[model samples]
Target: MGWYGQVKTNRQLQVRCNYLNGTVNKYLRPIGGITIVADIEQMKISEYIDRAVIPLPKAEGTDYRASTITPPFGPRFNAAPPKPRGQTGFKLDGNVVSWANWKFHLAFDARVGPVISLASIYDAKKKSYRQVMYRSYISELFVLYQDPTEGWYRTMLFDSGEFGLGNFAVSLEPLNDCPSGAVFVDGYYAASDGKPVQVQDAMCIFERHSGDVMWRHSDVEREIRETRPDISIVVRMVSTVANYDYILDWEFKPSGSIKFLIGLTGVLQVKAVPYTNTDQIKEEVYGTLVAGNTIGISHDHFLTYHLDLDIDGDANSFMKTRLITKRVKDKNIPRKSYWNVEHEIAKTESDAKIQIGLNPPELLVVNPNKETKLGNNVGYRLVPGSAARPLLTIDDFPQIRAAFTNNNVWVTPYNKSEKWAGGRFVDRSRGDDTLAVWTEKNRRIENKDIVMWYTVGFHHVTCQEDFPVMPTLSVGFELKPTNFFEYSPVLKTVPPQHLSWANCTK
Candidate 1:
């Protein structure tokens, strides 16, 4: 009944009120064969079929509150670190954040959780901030389930387009969610009734020092040792999308690198089965049996990002430096093979579409007009995340609707209107207005203002550990300076005497 193509109206919804004890957790309980489809616009509802009735799932031991647990808890993994004595390194002037050598503007959007714009890093050598990225954000997010049952076939979700990621974002907990010195920021949005609603503590920003070194070198023969502290500023937010919680982070480092992290955690979407144990099953249940009569369905998640990278200026081009293997022709050569880098400039959007794999080329967005002193292009290279492509066929409805995920990386001419990857209006949307359709035009992109779209994804195959609640699973990508920097910026950071170790005798 929820199947859109089968129904006449696209605004129709199929609803089932299942029971887990007295609570309705539709995933763990199914009302068996009864479905009611209602249309929101026309205000019409079709008659439902009542073929069977199943027993309600017992919701014993479902309480997750800290006070309700009877057994002793396990040992804690982390201890509170020592508090800092000095003022924080980062400064928050309204929405503009300045930390170390990086300055960026951060804003919350109803569609996407966070919008990072005018992100430029300062160059001490030049004594001016250079353009790195103009605007960057998560364009669209698609989560597709793999169950083929009648009630679950149409379980795909366009989280960002259909339901705004910011709309579902909840308040972040202090000290627990963020560090002790984190600065909290609030957000506001218009409600359905056209009233401004404020979401307090919507985001937090803090500098992270995880006891990791930025750079280190030791020379016993020369009696020399040096190291630099690894410090980075992090802007964090958590969006609660129904049964899933997404933790989004934007990290800025002193070396002119930016990282985007997507952490997924929440209850698993489960199905009520007839049998209680896996030993009693013989056929494909479409998932793994986690608990009594509960089957956790397998699924895939894809979050496509719209990165408008301006390496040094607005005019930029995409370059793929492929590492192709070269066989040794000379028999006297000791090495059997070596890899040579073949640089290719993407002339059009079609030329930039790439599928990353075991042998992925080095993807970069560089300014053709700007170069280092050695004449190397000024660019920021992409470090791809744990990206996963859809296993479904291209003709599949979900695959077609989210056709942007066909490739792990894509480059398109900067068009202001073409922001959303799944389309403008994703409510019961088809594949018509997807990113794949727009790229068919294949506009010229060489040395022009272009956007690079990167997909951060993962395939989730459920296990017993993900049952009652799941641990946070994270995956993301990084944009690092390639030839954009003249040399490592960490070399200029003066370390304190405590960290310098100059007095130690070798």
Candidate 2:
């Protein structure tokens, strides 16, 4: 039912059956042309629509479970892995974890899965642990599919707020979901009935040793080289929201950088159609036809995070450094124009609102009172990668409620109630309490305890390859030291000692 001017206004749940019919993937088989609209409050069906008789998706080759495959899939590695290392590399006491130069408390939220609180990094120069971010977690995400049809238009979803991330946390597979040496953590959250429900292996902590170098230099002139192995600790959780799996990782690096990594992989919410090839369709499909009788729905994912960066202390300001092009005053220089940084310390909440991907400025959350040895303000830069802005018009219902995606970045005074980017009451929300509405106050945030919000957007245009199950499409952003350290923190650090060399056997 179209929700524009009032077609069906009652609280409703449109039911679509996906019952497994002979080994077919439930998601791949959305029983089309039949929708059951039931008003739970009234406890009756408002409408039972059966418009057309659409052929069901084939039952062949639709099952993805390994056990269902005809030939067994072999193990990832041919040979057994090496023995475990002598050290576990991280210390865990209850919910608190200490790894590398980082120490933080890990807790689970009913709405947001894993919460990293009191996150501080050790400072060798200060001989103590200094606060970087007090607490950080993904607040909400808007998964909006681009289909104007009566059955598909209402697919706009607030993943975390409507369906709690903690509620969807699935137990991770060993050695597959995580490495051999990873430590698993259990999660618990309150159910609707107020009883605590526990999810085992809900999260994992592992030290990633990818071959990528952390730091390396080759001084051929002096015939010398220095290199450090890239070793970082990752706290990971996977939230399966019906048809999508969002793998979230909080990676802490030894080089004083923190990365928020998200990988999207799962079955696409495909629409069943009559066409098998592109040439057969004459009208707007709204998506690509990856399989016979299937149209992969085009969609957008906006993942917004809440970062309460203490930055050595609570009183911090967000800075935007715009690179401005200036012409040479004197025609003495060979270059006609040169660019230099023009810094602006955000005085109010509105001043910090930024739409990324358009001459994006260098973003930094800095403590003005704290300085380095060279008298530079201490700060951590927001290194945005693959940013996105909403493409939908402002009047759209989804855009109105999820107006937080209007800007890639926003800073607001830290408020306990303002944690949810989309209003806390997201189910059937009317955009009255969104971050976009809260910032309308234009409150003063300079030198105040503030929280920074960042949105990572993925504008997915459905393609042939993304049809069945999507291979991981990953995107991430980093928080790196700016002028916080006088020098590279790892410059003077000793390289990790290798315990042994490979032995040549007879």
Candidate 3:
């Protein structure tokens, strides 16, 4: 009996080891059900560590070069006018005439990916205080294509840090650095007491592949129309949050693809944390790492969802529901109609549901007392278990579902409001919010519903020196295959190739 107990305990210990390392077996029988819970608690500490290191497939060859893509515009500073209106007397007759030109400096470091490098930092001793500087990484690649014949431009899909894949677009006009369609969509009036004055410029990056435009207009139009339209677009701007100071622009392609690009002109600072693995470190040890060195925690990840009601004759609009731990059978609270309630009540209920599970310490609510900031016009909180939880686990499904069902609000062309990111009215200076009005008109004409869903994720392990000016990091969202696409759009495209020194030598 003694020997048998020893063997059983050994087996349990082994199981615990696997669980802590994220190699838990789905079908393994526990020695006893009660003991498993204890093991899980003990294992949770290391589980946090596992979440910090996202295991991407190793690059097949050393010679594989990262894409040489810069933001279509110059850096954010360049995008700003040389002088503010107070200094430049361009505002003749009390009406600003020629606005200062804005440009974006979107550059990516070839040495390393944003996520990897931003998680590492360095310190320099300046005159008085020890100054820290962070390196920048490639958050995402934004590719804009204009099918000259079609008379419309669309953005291509690319990877945005930890966020999943989707079509993302940024509306840039000849006049301003603000997202083209969004400035007016979100309704930031310069006349407002605290809003910045409107500035316009006409400088943007335009790149064209030899045959990409021709191929798109000729052979890709039908394919593009048939493609899924649930693309994602996000806008990142300087905000009150500590250490998060970059504006992200996101969009969904008409092809149902997702695209995201980074607009960096924000404050960067070093944040100190208790430990590399906080939970694992004991009471006496002071575990600390710079904020930039932390691997999985993203400044923010925003998701923009556009569902078309015209499809399937609008017989039944597809709705994704949050996974409720305790299932409720009230059909009146149909998942599809959950957003019909009063906006405030809806938001409260949504917050309640997200708070139920394992919540993160850093996640907080948008202040009700404070005046509205960029995307905070609508309320949002970071859902807990973002980093520690599994991507498609039962614990997380409901939160995802709730985001779609509860956070949704019907937007009309006339409604000029903005959330944390993308919406109909993007540009504030435009006389009429084109995208907002267009979307509203389209919704009525086509009898379609426009809704958006967002999710945030994180990873926690970080290093030192990610203080002062920290390096850049990347985060994003994805639009999965949900019968949304008419055909397998990616089927015709070839898989990505692996380049190596050996291939070149051959």
Candidate 4:
């Protein structure tokens, strides 16, 4: 019902009648119909005021709950480190010496069994010296790829008993006793006795779905010839690393698209940026507004591409295809400011033209001079989202520094500290952790230049089951925090919500 009509005829009828009589000089004094005219302005004003003053029910806070969020996905259960399965031991007989943390007690037939090399290093903490070694297996076979997605590539490591790099050992042993002109098949290494060694483990074949063994390499070639009419294979050895290992990187360019993939295993740590007293610029520049021991963070932005193919012939005559994309750009600030493009198109065998162009993006300032400092020589500390006001003294600087230097913070070898991955202090004579080497030839660590390096992997404690192929793994890097916000510096300002709502009501 209409508000005015409902008010006059219903529960408020008495109030409305009193209001009308007061404005009309009591109905008794009303003149004849033609001469009487009522004033209605005061009654309308009273009704408006009553409606405006009515109270609204408050919103319920308890029901406005948020759902629990989960962390990024990782392995369901951690696998224990692997144990050696072969009958091999260290022999300290010649210039080719080897070592291991554990004692070597086994022997193997020289012709068919794998040779082991051990190198020793004194461990002050353990109050003893230990030996480290490397054991490898070699083979040739066909590997298959099931999923060819951009970031996720699934391939089977076939033709070996265990076809992946595991936590083995590594050492530089001399190869003096190897046959002068004989060609080594695959898993070949030198022993501490200066003699050549070969791995004897049989090749392993894998089932596509369950990751189980379907056939051994000894039986696969025969079975495939009898069943499938056409097949292709490549010659490569399946090997493992010892205590320390580096990632095997490859740049794939298919149809003018480039994609870089890094396979990981072994011990790895995250990289950190360091801000020291020396990084401060003496001149007052737009972005060089250093406050105290603090300096600004910087970043490099660039683009890369990826490709996929659909082939239908032998390795030589197969058709090729690809996709282009910008994998990631330098992110100095919270929000990302870049674009991505992808496509899929095929090309005839003769028409294939693939190239890679690794171009650097235009350099731009991220954050202007902001207050920053090295927190206890562990990590870079900064007041992000705004410029830190000028600090008057050293005490004031440390106060701001203490707030960000708690646990879970770390320093890495990225900038001047890049001389060592664990940071420059580990093996340097200066005893200063921040000491870095400046050289033009070293791409990973340069002096005073800002760069990002991130290390990723699992911390493994040794166990029996991981003796073979370790699981596939990966980690990532991020542009460190900087003031190079893409838009205006005041973008963080909050607007007046209540004032805007009131204006809308008026």
Residues 1-506, candidate 3: write the lDDT tens digits: 00111213211121211111221221111111111112333553221112122222111211111253334744446342232222321222221112111111222211111111111111111112110111112222211121111111111112231121111112233334442222211112233265543212211222111122211222465654322112222222322122233344332222232233433322222122233455644543212333212221222232232222122122122222243234445877755422221122123222222222432222222223222223321112222223222222322322222222122222221122422122222111121222222333333211222222223333323334333233555554333223333343333332224346443666
Instruction: Kindly list the per-residue Cα lDDT of model 4 for residues 388-478, writing each as its tens digit.
Output: 2112232332212111111111111123223221222211112122111222123321111232211211222322122122244432221
After superposition, the stretches of candidate 2 with alpha carbons farther than 4 Å from their true spots are 1-9, 71-87, 499-506
Among all windows of 10 consecutive residues in model 4, the one with the lowest summed lDDT is: 305-314
**Reference-based TM-score, model 1:** 0.94
Q: Report the error of model 4 at residue 238, Å.
A: 10
Number of the predicted model whose TM-score against the real structure is largest? 2
Return the TM-score for each candidate structure.
0.94, 0.95, 0.29, 0.18
Give per-residue CA lDDT, model 1, range 1-506, as digits (tens): 22235435457676665665643444556555555767767888764666555444556544455666677788667655534422467888989999889999999998988999999999988889999999998999999889987666877888899889888888988777888778888878888898988889998888888678988999999999988888899999898998888999999988888999888887788776776778889988888987777778999999999999988899999999999999989999899999899999999989999999988999999999998998999999999988578899987777878899999999999999999998898877777887889999999999999999998888899998886678888888899999998888778888744543355675
**What RMSD, rounded to one decimal, does every model reach?**
3.2, 2.3, 23.9, 34.9
TM-score of 2: 0.95
Which 10 consecutive positions of candidate 1 have the poorest summed lDDT?
1-10
Q: Which one is best on lDDT?
A: 2
Off by over 4 Å in 4: 1-247, 252-418, 425-449, 457-471, 474-506
Question: What range of 10 consecutive residues in model 2 has the weakest lDDT sum?
Answer: 78-87
Cα lDDT tens digits, model 2, 220-248, are 99999999888899999999999999999
Any runs in candidate 3 off by more than 4 Å, and if so which? 1-196, 199-243, 251-255, 260-287, 291-316, 319-450, 459-461, 480-506
lDDT of model 2 at residue 438?
91
Candidates 1 and 3, the one with greater TM-score: 1
| TM-score of decoy 4 | 0.18
